[model samples]
Target chain A: MDIVVKKIVREVKRGNQDAFAELVDLYKDKVFHIAYRMLGNAHEAQDVSQEAFLRAYTNIESYDENRKFSTWIFRIATNLSIDRIRRKKPDFHLEDQVSGTDNLDYHSQFAADIDLPEDQVVKLEMQQWIQDEIMALPPKYRSAIILKYLEDLSLKEISEVMNLPVATVKTRIHRGREALRKRLGQA
Target chain B: MACTRDKQQVINQYLDEEMTLLESKQFEEHLHSCPDCEKHVRELKKTTAIIQSASHFEAPKDFTAGVMDRLPKQSKTKRWQQWIRRHPIVLTAAVFFLVFVTSLSAGFGAEEEIVVRGDGHFIINESERTVVIPEGSAIQGDLFIRNGDVEVNGEVAGDITVVNGRHLQASSAQISGDIEEINQTFEWLWFEMKTLWNDAVPFLTPASEEE
Candidate 1:
């Protein structure tokens, strides 16, 4: 996967616009999801995701291909999204506005093979509940937790993306887990 | 082995899979004996699993195309803007240094007063810390004297303006221009604006480029 990404990156560095477009295609959903989850605004998520890809392309020459391209792009996306959120809402507390819907149509296959529609509904609600808890976390801790669990990145990867120490990333994930556990009580 | 430290720490490390083999064994043993700790670990695991299982939304159609369209064209101005964004602190310091140096140059001059002497030209002489237009010679253009006193002793062809000092014009000094001592508040404001504008030109270029 890294080799394929690197090959595309090389093509991009050689001024292949198509290759850059392909790279954006590969990471767009991941970037959008991260931005959407963080900002809770689909429009802002789109803007941030677009801006992230633009920035990545603009700085492609500076990118070190030795590292995971996903890490670098995710770092850009998260930073742009977080910065946008911070700028628009400086006093970002736990917004009670869980405006996202359960659009798991694409991912429903990953859920348990339950025949009951009510079971699926309960699962989606539970997933939404978890998402609200995740969003309630401070952006720093939220990013760490999302990258660690959702994106399935290692502590080292999260640290690299966040430009934080590995220890700090671990601490944030732990604190985020603790916060979620408190909210998700005895479930 | 006995568990002595914070149980929460052990649970967190266990969930993260960071515990050593020995530590894991001890933590599992402690968890079996401690129902509360076990529940805490279970809830944490559930929380993590739910987050991991959260549905991911696909990017909207034409999202990559939008990004491609919005990507900055490979232009010199774009590259320059990128450079400025990357080194903002350095750019700020450079602007500060330039403003400092320019203001210093405008504000601080040599203690020796400037002497301009030419036939049929401005013969403003600042000997003994004064601008004295010596007799018979004419200042051809505008004369601006700052600091010290201005003593006009000869002919002048243009405006003679003195600031922050007394203007002493000899009766025998021929004057074909206005002898104005500009000491108004607005004049000072205008002078300050001119100085700032001159010093700020380089710093304003990037902003214009961005636009």
Candidate 2:
């Protein structure tokens, strides 16, 4: 561990709430991004992120120093998001709600304005298409892809984050990309 | 092997830059001869690029502030106090020192002739009395008393000897020896009293000069 991280761990062990708060500040954005990408909703992402941090704080003692703190936090966020997805009862009408809401209109407008730069517009469209394909994947495969590519984590790191073996992580990432390519009609 | 699914997976790893140099060269050799696998590699690279370039979600503003505000305040003093309290050696030493100080301030009244023997044992030479040990001596043997109170000082190497005594003061004493009492009249009240006293002392004492 870095000296600062060691100090944070010591402080947290000693019940120093400020040190914990600093830790939360340092990793909150990255955690939120991972959760948001996995869950696809700002509110649910925020909830999962908060829950992850809270769980991390409560179980801070169990954190292994040999692993990166970011990996551990992301693991918590990913697990929580996966749990939410699994527990969510299928509701067909929810799709209508998502597309019908003013929030979708606002997001679409935001997406449009974001693509205003002419040279990047095509790239942005392609990214949007790929993101759609990723979202269409099963939650397990989606998580594997996001961690491997979007987060650019190593197979070992992804394994640690997902609580799986390195081989499993590798297989998931490969299979996820294959599935995504097929879904995007590139296969 | 030119376009097997396993070869395609390896090629994907190669395109993702996750393969070793030797593996990359091998994958490229396969890709060179197989146009289908080569196309697959290009598509996978484009897909990786697309996902990598996607905008990362930003957390709401005030996220940190909100979490911190919801979190309980960190009290350095409280933490320090808890740290001190949790250390068994420190806690024991502290309680020992405290009982010593209180015993000294209360004064070993003339009613008890509490004679700690040279062999590191306490000898209460009187009957039907109380003995209080102040915190700085080394006694080596079990206390032996026929009918008197006994108190321990510092570290004793042997068992306590109590005979029809009213009270045994064992605070501030690390007895490596067991305690032996021969009568029901020997009350073990002072240790509890001292513990209660130590716990309550901070509240009652006037505020000393702040550290």
Candidate 3:
């Protein structure tokens, strides 16, 4: 997959604009999920995800092919997500007025493997509750927690994406989970 | 005494799979003895699990096309900036020529006093540090004014650069080229560097190639 992605990146660097769509297709869900969970709004997440792909396309020349592409793109999405989280008023996402159908859109987008409707709905509510808890933490801890667990990045990867030391990333994840634990007790 | 901080650190490490086998073994043993740590670890595990289990969403179907649409077409400002970056030598030389011509036309003897260098316009108030081109007047070349406020009520055919000063234009004032005000030290240094670059990089192209 890395080889395939590198081929596409080379094409993009050579001025093949359409070739960037493949990269967008390859990493869209991962990028969108990180931004979605980080900003807690589907609309903003979608906007940020699109922006990440556009930036990756424009700056494809700067990308080092030897390194992992996921880390590079993930770094861009995470930084944009944190910026959006910090610059906005706190009252916004609490009401989370991102279209009435954001959750519905998620359901339709992932409706492929619905084994049991009853079990899926309960699990989805639990997931939503957990997402709300993630949004409640400060932006720094929220980014650390989401990247570590939701995005499945290692401590080293999170450190790279956040441009912090590995030890700092570890501390952030610890404190973030501690906060999540107390908020999650209602479940 | 409960080692809560140390145990808490390992809980996150353990959940993240960062613990080595030896650390994992010791932590498991510790959890067996410490009910408080065990419960805390249990809840934290559940939280992280829920996070990992959260559903992922695909970008909207039109997202790629949307991005392609908004991919910036270089604006006029960006184009000039790119031109400046691509041919720094030519721009510096052009700036050097400009300063040389300006100082020559303004005359060496007019230092600190009012010196307005243009083809032909009117009014220099040396006492007030002001120059005025009254209505119905026009200058054929670039205007270089030093340490003086300028009021242009007429038209000029070339650039207007005010050194360590400011320029005000009347409603009827017209300039065919750029208007530059150099009062800050940073812009002054840029002006100086352009003069130097003109000397060093004249081989790249003529000074007018910047246009």
Candidate 4:
């Protein structure tokens, strides 16, 4: 996967749309997932994802191949999501009633369809619960948690993505998890 | 025993898989004996799992095709046009050429005559050649003349040299240098309207015909 991405990146640097298309295909899912998780809306996530890819394509020359392409794309998506959230100035109180329904339904339906072991179901439910908890977090904590877990990025990668220091990323992740645990207990 | 603050650092390194095997084994041993640290690890793991599951999202169908449709088609002609528009030298040269042509055309049709930068020392040798220097004039350099007559009722700071001119005239004209004259007739007329008019349109109306 790394080699393929590197080749596609080279082609993209040369201004080849087909190469860029391959890259887009390669990471579009992950990018959309990150944006959706960060922004909590499908339409906004899609828009943010599209904008991220467009920005990446236009500025492909600026990308450093030595770094992970995934981290770079994730950074773009995450920043765009943050900007969109800031612009919306969404009232947090109403977010639960409005945004939680679709996700809750999706999780419930998936749970019903997937007849897994007891432990797996518990894990899946816990995962869904954590996601909802993350959404309820402040934007800063939410980004920290998403980058640390969903993207499975290192502290260094999270720092690069968030434009923060490694120590800051670690602190955010630590505090974010603590907050999630507290919220989970209340739930 | 209260879990030491160092336990948090240990947990962070453990989560990041940065600890060596011996360190991991030591931490695992510590967790086995400490329920508080064990609970912390479990909570952290659960939180990580939840975030991972919640973040799963799919891209919209035809996302790539949509993006490709919006991108401007790159072609050689388009690139060339954009390059020319952005190149500073090309743009500057184009603007200079336009200004030069416009100024040249405008100068040919101008009516009011004005001595832009020359000195007052001048001569006219042609049959109807007339020169007009306005009043309160100051010439800092020398002026020369050929086969045309001149009328300087203003001032000349340098030498007035004439050669084979018809008429050499100066009215209250100051010449700082020598006034060298060749084959030409000299005249001093006070308020010479014919000479003034003839000088105004020297090429059109010759002085001899006007006189």
Top-lDDT candidate index: 3
- CA lDDT, candidate 1, residue B181: 57
Compare the candidates by DockQ and give the number of the best one.
1
Per residue, candidate 1 scores C-alpha lDDT tens digits across B76-126 of 765676567657998999999999667655543445355333235343444
* Candidate 2 lDDT, B55-173, residue by residue in tens: 87778987876676666555788877767755779889989999976764443334434443336423334443555444677665555553456666567666666644544455676
> What does candidate 4's lDDT look like per residue over B134-187, in tens digits?
566766765555444456667776666544443345667766666654542222
Return the clash pairs for model 3, or none.
Answer: none
Off by over 4 Å in 2: A91-128, A185-187, B16-26, B72-211
Q: Candidate 2 versus the native: TM-score?
A: 0.58
lDDT of 1 by residue, A1-187 (tens): 7789989899778666667888988889999988888876689889998999888988999999888898999999999877886788454334333345453333433567557699788977776776677778988888888888878888899999999999998889888878887887566
Candidates ranked, most accurate by DockQ first: 1, 2, 4, 3
All models: lDDT? 0.76, 0.71, 0.80, 0.71
Worst 10 residues of 1 chain A by lDDT: A90-99
Best by TM-score: 2
- lDDT, candidate 2, equals 0.71
Docking class of 2: acceptable
lDDT against true structure, model 4: 0.71
Estimate, for each residue in A1-187, the C-alpha lDDT of model 2 and write its tens digit.
3667767877887777667878887788889988888877789889889888888878988988777889889999999999998987773433343555664533343333633777678766765666667767889889998988788788888998888998887778877877766555353
Q: Per-residue lDDT for A15-61 in model 3, tens only?
A: 55557778887888889888998888889999988888778877887
**Judged by DockQ cut-offs, is candidate 4 incorrect, acceptable, medium or high?**
acceptable
Which ten residues in a row are the worst by lDDT in model 1 chain B?
Answer: B115-124
